[model samples]
Target: MRQWLFALGGLLVWTAHFFAVYIAASLFPGEPLASWLTLGLTLVALVVVGWLGLGAWRVWEARGEDELRPWLGGIALMGAALSAIAILYAGLTAVFF
Candidate 1:
């Protein structure tokens, strides 16, 4: 039940990110930087959402399994690493540009 909820939440997050990007691009077709900003934000959001969805899937897979701890740990680690990279990129982009 919890796993399903988490998966649903991840799906919602993914959908929301796409919708936001699409709306931004559609509404500001002629604005400079609009597409770039939308793409950048969408990329970041999608990566984060993918990590979360992967984590949720891992949790779902681990529910009744005995040897799933390692996989779950790996998922968490991967998610954290990706998030860190995204943060680093955003910070650098903000500072330099």
Candidate 2:
């Protein structure tokens, strides 16, 4: 359970941020509040993803002779990178459009 959570943490955060931004946009329509909310959410998401990526990187580096640990860390790191890109794109689109 914990391992799965660690692996999917970045993706989960991205999903949550995506939904939150969508809801905020729907609620606020053309209001500036929606943009503000999106900006805040994007920053938070980035920070969280970055933290997760760092942890994953540490695991990857410290894997030593272990094979599975490196794989897990690599997957998590990739997920975090992808999530960051998605979060940024979504945030920009939501705020601008």
What's each prediction's TM-score? 0.48, 0.95
Compared with the true structure, model 1 gives a TM-score of: 0.48
lDDT of 1 by residue, 28-60 (tens): 776756657665765676577667756755654
Q: Report the error of model 1 at residue 1, Å.
A: 8.1
> Model 1: number of clashes?
0
Give Cα-based local distance difference scores for all models.
0.55, 0.94
Score candidate 2 by TM-score against the native: 0.95
Candidate RMSDs in order: 7.2, 0.9
